[model samples]
Target chain A: MSQAACIVGIGETDFCRKPGSGMSQLALQLRAATAAIQDAGLTPRVIDGIMPFPNLGRAEQFAANLGCENLRFAATIHTGGAAPVASLQAAATAVNAGMATHVLLPAGWNGYSGARVRQTVSQDVASIPGGAIARDYYLPFGFTAPPQWYSVMARRHMYEFGTTPEQLGTIAVTMRKHAQLNPKAVMHGRSMTLDDYLASPMLADPYRFFDCCLETDGAAAVVVTSAERARDLAAKPIQIMSGACGQPYPADEITNRKDFFRTGLSIAAPEAFGKAGIGPSDVDFAMIYDCFTFELLQQLEEAGFCKRGEGGHFVEGGRIELGGELPVNTHGGLLSEAHVLGMSHITEAVRQLRGEAEGRQVEGAEIGVVTGWGDFGDGSIAILRR
Target chain B: MSEYTKPLPELEGHTKDFYGFCKQGELHFQRCSACGTWRHVPRELCAECGSWDWEWARSSGRGEVYTWTVVGRALHPAFQQSCPYAPTVIELEEGVRLLSEVLDVAPEALEIGMPVEVVFEAVTDEITLPKFKRVAAS
Candidate 1:
């Protein structure tokens, strides 16, 4: 079999929830993408494939603007939060199958402290126009927003699993501490105590003020090429070992889900471990998405990192900290880092593998797993190794 | 449809799940005649035995807390006032989980294995959403 497709180059522009330059979204993509090509030491002419997550300044629109020639492949993948890893895997498949040698997976957005601070600023909030989640169960409940719709699971997790708001707050504080070491993080150095968590006003019971992910304006891009090409181009090569991704149980009603506590990630985990040829215990660093703290715990438990209901104790014991057993979200995750959606985590994994993370790098990290998690239980996992 | 908030969803004219007892202010689920499995969402077919044949019966609406979360972020337009509401999945006595709202209790008071019973909230003129209240017993 052909060797696994590898990430040859990764590039990102400066993050800003709001930029005054009035720079069009396409301009942001061009600059960041150009940086990626440069980082990989290749000309834009080498790019033969493009996989754009929908929320990014429209893929076809960007391609038309960039005047890309010989574009053999161009498409969009629609899984809400799992699109990042899915896109990477798609490109890897194309490359491994010789459909294309170079693939560009790009996504970015400004979800926070933007000039337009209104919630209705963009039609695209890193969500599909009318995905299965939107078209059916959630839309009727007026749950157009993800945090609102997903809070039910967190609340239920609290009720059934005995997870606490303090534990939830601990998830936020942990990411914040990790962010303190990441200059790019939006919530860095802004840690909250359990008291602060419980005292903070409620957005939903069980979930506190600090129990949500931060939405920031930023853009990140990733470049994928065959393993042999990556070995020749970059000084460091991070092997894209395997990926496990899928949507929620489709037959399961969007609203009347059988178990709100469990997710498709629970289903995706075993397949991922099977593909990676390792169990959860072998993972040295984990970049589990913290779109919400509840998701962090749910994903950890479902992915077989620990048994069910042990997430709170696992986190309370400080196992997720910078030097802990399995340092997660060293880039502060989507919680403390930036939620230009989950693309940043993918880039961070590449950075960690390259040993470029200045301070938050896991000690002698050999195996890193990054997960794209959120949006009513749609997610994916990427296992990377040095 | 006219815009009016109802505490309960309209169950009339809906197929499956709630037995006649719910119309009489009770909750119910379908039991598999072959496997004795209780199924929620009022399926037209039994999930357990893959039998289209099933039976409906009134349930105590009592069960243990399965899992739940409190939404801190206001996501729904209808839930603008309901932001930070607790949504839960309760495992009923008949062995079926139903997603509904929880009420008359603090988050700290809610726990796994806590005894809970169904309570309906009047949301719209024609609808009442099934919610749960702690029963003070496991």
Candidate 2:
């Protein structure tokens, strides 16, 4: 909140199921990082800060690859899917503090081509055995994967709010429709109907195959700098109007949390909107993370877009479609688009603000909100304005 | 059900008593001796009172099915043969929650707020797993 920080560039690697070309994570990250720098009409030499998602370590490797001469600040966030935009908070802080000039924010994962398949049956995964507090409590009861773990929350939502599977299916259907317009989307050209969603095999109770996001292999990067620098750059500056990351009490474990129906976003949205000098109604569009369909619905309600328990009705009737009020995930989202750990959601918001979202543009869009959800209950939100 | 081995919980300093009670076929929770706050998944100190002084208080094992999921897909080698199983979270009468496998009812029949009670199953020589079965409506 000191000096305004702005996102001046956005870039991403091609969406692929498998990078059989032996595409390492570093290669994917550098490609997006280079593209983002070039997109901002700035050279890598100007980048002095880097905020990366976990596993993409050491800013020096990135600086070396980008030809950046002075990498002054570097940090990595491991807050699950929420880290990408959540990381922007740290970058903006550094930029506001004058600790760094331009910062590169990147996220990518080879879930399809990498350890995802190998990890399906392997017990060697460190995080699997008594790694997290929640795991220690839930694993013994046969709650192994996310689908099973999150199903508890999903079922509760249904019981408390009468949220139906069809309502959840609406989200998947809406995202797939949006992906149809985005050529870069992994599910582009592949259509899904509500029937398909209902018919999809159940991974866990209340979660069918369509309820989950794709295990994608891709990366996205954004360039953040001072508002002054952003204005001189090539892309229209997306002002960091407001941003926050929060975890409510007992956030470490789902069972220990006070209210499963409420998430950290319930606390964060007010802070973010207040900082932006706006409200959820004032926002033109949203890029809510869709790690699962239930999460999408819950976040919408928790973010104050609708009354709690009303997200099911709010998303109905094509309200979240491209031409609907507060169009969401115009670039398909993780469900249909490539899951770049929600960084691509940031990129999509940038595109919408710049009027560059060709087929999926929300007309007269000047303000957009992007969000991230992870770590059982950690939530992050940011409001951007053109 | 076919016999198999799965990853078990580590019975450390804080968790030993909780599982030790399980070996005796009794459900117990960590209650802060100072503040009388009930806690689950055993911790070193009480969250409410920040007091390390606590005692393993026996639970009545009577609770309602708060939420549940039927994992149609197997995630671990131990569960490969049990392709579809129900994992449930039960909120005990004492206002504390714990995770366990739900049995004696079809997955589709599981409902929120349904009464349930705990039953122990000795899965391995060293570890006894706690499970839940739906209580008949009185």
Clashes of each: 36, 0
Predicted candidate 2 versus true structure: per-residue lDDT over A1-386, tens digit per residue: 43579999999888879553268888888888888988999999989999878665568788888888898999887667788878887788788889999999988868788767334523533543225454456766777777776778998988888999999999999999999999999899899999999999988878998998898788899999988777677888888988898875666567656577767788888899988888899989999999899899888998999998899999999899988987989998989998888999999999999999998889999889999987665789999888
Error of 1 at A303 (Å): 2.8
Write down the C-alpha DockQ for each prediction: 0.29, 0.63
Please state the CAPRI-style docking class of candidate 2.
Answer: medium
Cα misplacement distance, residue A43 of candidate 1 (Å): 2.9
Give the alpha carbon lDDT tens digit for every residue of A77-185 in model 1. Answer: 7776678877777888888888887788877654554433225521233343334323222333344455555666666566567887778888888887888898877
* Candidate 2 lDDT for residue A66: 86
lDDT of each: 0.70, 0.84
Candidate 2: stretches off by over 4 Å: A18-21, A117-132, B1-3
Give fnat of each prediction, in order: 0.46, 0.63
The list of candidate 1 runs beyond 4 A from truth reads A18-21, A24-26, A55-58, A113-145, A148-164, A189-198, A247-262, A316-318, B1-67, B71-73, B82-84, B102-138
